[model samples]
Target chain A: MRYAMVIDTLKCVGCSDCVVACQTENDVPVGYCRDWITETVDGSYPNVVLELKSERCNHCENAPCVRCCPTGASHIIDGGIVLVTPNECIGCGACIESCPYDARYSHPEGGYVDKCTFCNHRLEKGQLPACVSVCPTNCMYFGDLDNPNSKVSRLLKNRKYKTLAPEAGTKPQVYYLI
Target chain B: MQEEIFVSGRDIPNIDPSLEIWHWPIGLYLFLGGLAAGIILFASIVVILNKEDEYPTTVKYASIIPPIALVIGLIALIYDLKNPLYSWQLYTTIRIESPMSWGAWVLLIVTPLSFLWVFSYFSELFPTWDLKFEWLKKFEQFVKKNRKNMAYLLVPLSIILGVYTGILLSAFNARPLWNNAILGPLFLTSGLSTGAAAIILLAKTAQERHLFGKVDLALIIIELGLIIHMLMGMYAGSEVQLEAMRLLVGGEFTVLFFGFVVILGLIIPGILEALEIKGYKVPVAIPALLVLIGGLIFRFVMVEAGQITRYLY
Candidate 1:
């Protein structure tokens, strides 16, 4: 089954509680991030529009990081959870550079690339990703995209959404509904 | 009402410098690797043309460069990694699609082959200079026997190494400045130009020096074309791509890009080499020196500028 993340940009209010939860759950080091926010201002003068964008790994179907990794450290596994095998990571930074979203970080202590993993550690326990669970706005949704009955599939059927850098040909699984 | 959307990484409104993921070590590694590859490529061609004996400085000096440069480059690369110890894993598995994989294999192949190429030169140079060690003699004999096959092997691998220097960056879709298709050929030409300039500086024979001077001039002209093509392509790209090009054209690195890389690296050196080719007197060493410095500065600027940019704000 193909897993997906749907973020409702209209509902997000720039709160970074998800970021905090992600850091704490993963034991991420200070001054580094596995996922972060992108706050952008569009329009001008009286009609300005500001967007709080929580950006992270897209887990693209055609992942460039997977292609450019010399070793098998960066790989896509079941349900399309793109992950880094820390023990095997040579810390070459190829996967980090290959990501268009700037979603991956070179872990300071581990010397390997790290990014949002759908909280796979939590997923195995049949739980929501840390970000989705902590998001106070209820703006984040996760489900198996291949399952027509899943919430994510219903949301896509009901709304318009877009993916980042579609021209990159990565086919990102994350969707943002405005 | 008018509308505009701008992307900036000004994360947390920080006045402090943003965190850098890769630094000088990676830049230095790319520079040194490119320089060594350029030399090996040119030297392999010389040997294939049966001009090795005629251009002793080009053969001897050039052969030694790859081993030294590749060793230092590999060290810098490992040192840049967060876990330097895990680099050993690069050898056990190969991902054919990854430029880094190609890089790992290229280094493994070219390093030892280049060392033996140097030893092959030792057999030729030692007897004439009347200097010899027993093991060197024996090693040189083996190298001489296999030299032809080795040169054939080095020629393509050196080209791969040279192009890979740029491919390593271009493979990264995250950094728009480096993601251009022209980067591969542009870097290869730059490597060749600087490689020829380096040989010109060390060649003892006037004929060998003049030949390399001409070669360097041609490479510089081609490099100029490639650089322009790369810039123009980026300027026509998406908003983010245009912003990336601005870093080189009108941003922090503008002076370094237009002033150093364009004028000193290509223009001045190109004029000097042209004059010398026309039978006019001009010191080759100065332009050769500038080209080397320019080659280094180009890599440094590209690496740093690429890192300063991001896809989100």
Candidate 2:
């Protein structure tokens, strides 16, 4: 089952609760982040609009990081979750460099690349991603996109949405509902 | 109607400096690896054609470059990795689609093969090397007996090695500056030109130096054309692609790209060769050195600029 996330921008409050939750849950270092929000200003002063986009690892179908990685450290496992094998990782940073989304960060302690893992540790215990479970605005929807009955799939079916950098041809799994 | 909005990631710039992963080590590795590949390619071609007598001094001296340079490049590559201690993981499983995987295996094969090629040449240059080690003498004999066959084998390997240097960068589709298909051939040409330049500087005989000088000038012209085409490709692409063009043509890297690479690396060297061709016999080593240094800076600029490319803002 291809797990995916659908974020509704209209409902998002730009509160950054998910960011803090992700950091605390993942034990991310001080200088690094697993997920964050992008805020942009549009139009001139009179008609100005602030657009906020929450983003993280796209978990692309054709991941550049995976393709460029020299070692088998960055590999796709069951459920199409792209994970890094820390022990096997040579810390060449090829994956970190190649990722278009800047999803991966070089960990100060481990020296290996780290990124949003869909909260795999929590997932194994049948729990939602930290960011999704903790988002106060209820803007995040995470489920199996491959299943038409899944919440994410149903939301995608009913909503008008966008994805980042479609031209990059990464086929991102994250969807942004307008 | 749709309103044009300034787009940004939740917390990222188009090019995030804080997320930079590759550094000087990678740039040096690319430069050295390309240099080694270029030397091996040139030497193997000269040796395989049995033109050793014509390029007598070059045959002995130039042939030694690949082994030495490859060793150094490998060391740089090893140290560049964050987990240098876990480098064995690169070989434990081969990912056919990964350029880095191919690089690991290719370097493994090319290093020792090049060392053997250099060993074969050393015996001819310094016979005393054989007196010290019986194994060395025996290995040298084996290499001498099959020198032509070895030369032929190295031809493809060296070319692949040279091309891989560029392929490594180009494989990163995320970095529009490095995603060009022309990067492979462009880097290959650059490396070979530097290799030729090195020969011009090292060859003891006037004729050999002159010949390599001529070769380098031709390579410089080709390199210039490729650079232009590469920039044009980026400029003519999508908005992000055009932004990539700014890095090389008129952005932060403008001076480095045009001043050092175009003027000092290509044009000045061409002018130097023109004087030599006109019987002026201007210093060849100077231009040769410029080309080599230019090659190094080329890798540096590419790596640095590529990280700061416009994408996924």
Candidate 3:
């Protein structure tokens, strides 16, 4: 079954609880964020709307990062999660550049490129991702997208959704309810 | 709210003050790889065109330099990696879609082929003790045949390596500045020019060899045309791409773009070539040196400029 996350922007108060939770859980380095929010201001200051997008690895069906990795360091797991094998990575940074979402980064100490692995360890234990579990507003939803009865699948069917950078043709597993 | 927008989860911020390690090494690797590929291409052309006899010293030195440069370039690339030990995995696992993977494969195959080619070309310089062993004779004959094939095979391979360097950057569609389709051709053309200039300078001074005047003149003209096309293509592209032209022409990279790439790399070399064609004696070393410098600077400016301009708002 395909796994996916649906974020509700209306409910998201631009709180970064998700970012903090992911970092603390994964032991991600400082300054280099695995998940973060980007704020865009539309129109002039007086008439502006602050658009906040929490970005991370899209876990694309046709991931360019996977395609650009020379040593097969970047791979898609059985559950459609894009993961990096640190031991096989030569730190070429080609995958980092190829990712359209700008989701990846070169690890400071390791030097190998890294991104969110959908909290694979947690998934194996049948636990929700840190971001999903900690989100106070109940804005983030994660479940089996392929299972018709799953929360994410039902939400996708009921709500109008949009994927980031649709032009990239990456078939991102992350969907957003605008 | 302000704290959340840009706050670190860990008490200590993870700012790597130094830019990524891959930056310098990758740049050096691309430059040297292009140079080596160009040199090999130039030498093969001379051999195939039956002009090697006239420029024996040039072909000899050119062939020798590529293997050395290839070794250096490969080392620089591997040294910058986070896990240097894992570099050997590149050879074992082959991925066709990745340009980096393709480069690793190319380098592996080309390194030994290049050595064999150069060794066979200079076999006469080594003392030949004919061993009566049939197997040894057969091995020698096989090497000789392989060398001939290498000479012919490397022409396309060199072009591929040269162009692949440009394609590496162009593959990044998010970076509109580097996504131009013309990058491949422009890189291939510049590689040839730089490669030719390097050989010409080295052969004339280091090896005391002279090239056929007509051939030198012809190459210069072709190189000039390619540079013009490359510049024109960049200028005519989208505003984001035109930013590259601006950086070169009136922007921060002006000195490097006009002073080094255009004037020293193309203009001076073109003028000297013209003078030679006009029956005027011009020192070949001067123009050749300028050409080599120009090529190096072109790569430096292009790479630096591409990185500095960011569209991320």
Candidate 4:
């Protein structure tokens, strides 16, 4: 099953609750985060437009991080969820340089690169990702993109959406509904 | 129209508006790797062409550089690694598509190969020295007997090592400045030029120095051509690449790239070497040292600036 995340930008309130949820769920360091809110403002003063959404690892199908890693530290799992084996990573930063989304950070304590894992632990227990489950605005959707009836697939099918850095050809699984 | 973008919750180190993942150590590693590659490449050619008798320093003396340089370069590389203890995992499996994997494997093979090459010439360099074990003595003899074969292997491996230095940077498609295709050839040419300069510094005779001075001059010209080619390609590329190229030209790195790397590193040295080749009296050390310094600064600028140019920014 191909997993994906669809974020509804219109419904997002820039509250950053999902950011906190991810931190608490994953035990991310105080100075770091796996998912974060981004605010984009466009146009001259009076005609300006603002867009807010949470950003994290795209878990790309053709992931550059996976391909560039010297060791098999970075890899995609059964559901297309990209994961890092902390013990195996040489911490060369090659994966960090290859990521288009700027999603990864070198773990200060573990001495390995770390990023969003799609809450794979919770997924094994048949639960949604922390960011999706904790989003107060209910704007985040997560499910198998291959299943036509899945919420993520249905929203992507029915809505006008865009992925960040589409020209990178990474085939990112994260989509933002405009 | 004026537009502004603000990102929050990005307090993470090294991944804010841009990435600053690689630092000075990586640049130093590239520089040393190139130097060693160039030395081995030229030394191997000297052996393969049967010019070892005439170019004793280039063939025998220069063989000492690859091992020392590779050891120090590898140390710098490991020091930069957050989890250096796990670096051995790099050999567990080779990923064909990964340039880093290729580099790791190539280095693994070439490091020992370089030591063996040097070991083969050990007894001749020190007539009093003797191998502690008969087996090692026999092995040294075997290596010495097949010196030409070893040189043949080193020819291709050294080239791979040289090109791999640049390919490591170019493989990072996310960084606009480093995503260019010319980096491989550019870095290799610079390495060869630096290698020749090292030989010029060490050569005993004026003939040997002048010969490599001419070689350095040619390599310098090619390196300049590649640099121009890279800039032109970037300027003609997508908006992102144009923005990346701007970092090198008319931006923060303008002076470093033009003044330090281009003029100080290439142009002056090129001219001096050209004059030297034409029977003019120029101290070989001046141009040779400048070339080495310039080669080093070029790597530093590339690494630092490439990290600053990103798709999102």
Candidate 5:
């Protein structure tokens, strides 16, 4: 099943709970995060539009990171989640440079590139991703996109959505509903 | 009319405003690797042309460069690796689509070949030195006999290694500055130019110096043309591509790119070499040195600036 995350920019409060949840759940270093909040303001003087998004790895269908990784460290797994094998990674950072989303980061301790795994370890135990489960506003939706009845599929089918860097042709699994 | 972006909890180093994944060491690796590839390419050409006796620097003396340069370059590369101990994993599998994988494999094959190429010429270089073992002496004979065939192998592999330097950068589609296809030929041409310059620097005969001076001048012209062509393509590309070009043309890297790489590296050397070719009393070392330095600065600028140009905020 192709897993996907649908974030509602209109509902997100820019609270950054997902950022903290991801860090605590994944044991991400203090200065690093698997997901974060982004606020974009567009317009002039009196007219303005602000869009807040919780951004992370898109787990793209045509992931450049997976393709560019020399040692096969960055790869896609079941459900389209991109994961890094820390032991296999030579810490070359090629995948980091290839990612359009700037999702991956070089782990300082292990010397391997690391990024969001959709909380795959938790997913195996039938738990929602940390970011989604802890998001106070419930703006984040995660489920199988392959199942038409899933929350992600319903959101995409019913609402207007967009993906980050669509021009990159990565076919990112992460979707944002505005 | 304007757009402002702000992010909270995005304090991720090297990924917040822009990426700073690659640093000086990567630039150094690319430079030395390209230099080694160029030396091997030219050395192979000199061997294939049967000019070993006339151009000892190009064929014999220069033969010593690739092995040493590659070893040092690899050292720089390994040092830059976050997990340098895992560097051996590069040989486990061959990812055809990955330029780095291609480079790793090519280096594995070419490094030893470069050492062997140098070893085959040891007797001529040092008459007093002797291979005491029969097997070692026989292997040397085999290498000596197949020197031309080795050149044939080296010619294509060196070209691959040369182009791979650029291809490695270009393969990263996420970085607009490095995504262009021209980088392959551009880097290859620059490598060849630097290679020619190195030969000129080491050449003892006026004939060899003048011949390579002319060759370096030609390569410099082509490299200039490619640079202009690359900028033109970037100018006509998407918004991000324009921003990427601005990093070189009018942004922070402008001085480094135009001053060191363009003017000092190409134009001055081109002019000096041209004057030298025209029978003017010019020191060949001056232009050769400039070309080499320019080549190195070009790589540094590309790596540093390319990392700053990204698809996202």
Candidate 6:
């Protein structure tokens, strides 16, 4: 089954609870983050809108990171989850540069490139991701896209959604409903 | 106890607060490319001088040095990769749109051509006196006859290879610090300077081997001029480009660019070249060594400074 995430931009308060939860659960380094928020304020003072986007590895179907990687260290796993193997990573950071979304990071100690894994560990235990479970406003939804009954599939079918940098041809797994 | 759920908007996800420093790769690429350019320049100079006795030795040594440098550079590049082995796949597919693809192809093409050029030069070193091996003699004659043509082609090919590294970095429009038309010329000039220094060093080491009569002063002057031109280009460019120059002048890379490249690499060599013209054959060994080190620093500073600046501001 193709797994995916649907993020509701309206409900997000830009609180970094998801970032902390992912880092703590994955043991990610302090300085490097696998997911982050970007706040783009357009227009002058009187007519400005603070558009905050919480982004991570889009887990693109056609990943440039994998193409640029000299080794098979970065690859797409089952369910369209782009994962980086710490053992195989040589810390070249080419994948980091290749990524348009800027999702990857090089671990200071390990010297290996890293990004979101869609909380694969939690998925194996048949549980919701830490970010989804902890989100107070219920801004994040995760489920199998192939399953007609899944919450993600229902939202995708019924709502108007958008994907980041679609011109890059990465086919991002993350979908947004305005 | 009142159960109060309080959350602040300041906590964002996925934004890496710390910045990354990427000077090492740029430094390494510059050093390797400079060395390769230096070797080719020296070989061309020897050929143009028409020093027949020295021709074979210079060509043979020059051709061989690039492959060794290329190997070392390739290793450094792969070592930097998250998966070094998958770099081989880059060669399997030919994508003209990507500079990385172009670089991979250039490396592949230049490696074998360099090896062949060297092989042709060193063929005479291997004795084929015995008439019993008729095929070997014929092969040797064929190599000797075609060697000049190969050398002619190899010179421009090597120059392209050397300068392409700069163009590759500059092509990324998003990287404003590297986005300069002067990059190609800068790389070309630095390549010649480094190439000359490398050859001079090799000539000194092979002095006992009686490889040649004397290093030509004309070639030395040309190399010095190239270094001056490179510095002038950096000084005359835009403000963002000038920032890169500042990094080299009185800033972070001052010691490396001025102290090493100018003082040791160019000035001393230029002085020695002038002295040689005035009937004083000052020993070139020491100055050549200094030039070699200076050339390496030139590349290091240029590469690092180009990347250190902020792209947004």
lDDT of each: 0.83, 0.83, 0.74, 0.90, 0.90, 0.65
Over B1-313, each residue of candidate 5 has an lDDT whose tens digit, in order, gives 5454547555554456334777888888888888888889988998999988888888888778889989999988998888888988889999998999989999998999999999889889878988889998898899999999999999999999999999999999999999999999999999889889888989899998998999899999999999999999999999999999999998999999999999999999999999999999998999999999999999999998998888964
Residue B157 C-alpha lDDT in model 1: 94
Scoring model 2 with DockQ, what do you get? Answer: 0.53
User: How much DockQ does model 1 earn?
Assistant: 0.50
Could you tell me how far off, in angstroms, the CA of residue A161 lies in candidate 5 after the best superposition? 0.9
Model 4 agreement with the true structure over B87-203: per-residue lDDT tens digits: 999999999989999999999999999899899888877779877899999998899889899899999999999999999999988999999889999999999998999999999
Q: Is candidate 5 or candidate 6 better by DockQ?
A: 5
Of the candidates shown, which would achieve the greatest DockQ relative to the real structure? 5
TM-score of each: 0.93, 0.95, 0.86, 0.97, 0.98, 0.63
Question: Which of 2 and 3 is the better model by DockQ?
Answer: 2
The CAPRI category of model 1 is: medium
Off by over 4 Å in 4: B1-7, B12-19, B128-134
- TM-scores for chain B, listed for all candidates: 0.91, 0.92, 0.81, 0.95, 0.96, 0.74
Candidate 4's TM-score on the B chain: 0.95
Model 5 score (lDDT): 0.90
Q: How many angstroms is residue A117 displaced in model 5 relative to the true structure, after the best TM-score fit?
A: 0.2
Q: List the residue pairs that clash in candidate 4.
A: none
TM-score of chain B alone in model 3: 0.81
Report the C-alpha lDDT of model 2 over B9-74, residue by residue, as the tens digit: 223442245478788888888888888887887777888878888887556787788788888888
> What digit string (tens of lDDT, one per residue) describes model 6 on residues B67-148?
7887787777776554455455565656554556666677787777666656565545455635357786686578667766
Query: Positional deviation of A64 in candidate 6, in angstroms?
Result: 10
Worst lDDT run of 10 residues, candidate 1 chain B, spans: B7-16
Tell me the tens digit of each residue's lDDT in model 1 across A1-178: 9999999988888677778888889887776566677666777778788777677889999999899988888899999989999999988777776777767777656767777898998999999999899999999999999999999999998999989888888899999997
Docking class of 2: medium
| Predicted candidate 3 versus true structure: per-residue lDDT over B140-249, tens digit per residue | 66876665466788888988988887888777665555677767776776677667667666664422323433444565566567667766877887655676667767
Off by over 4 Å in 5: B1-4, B12-18
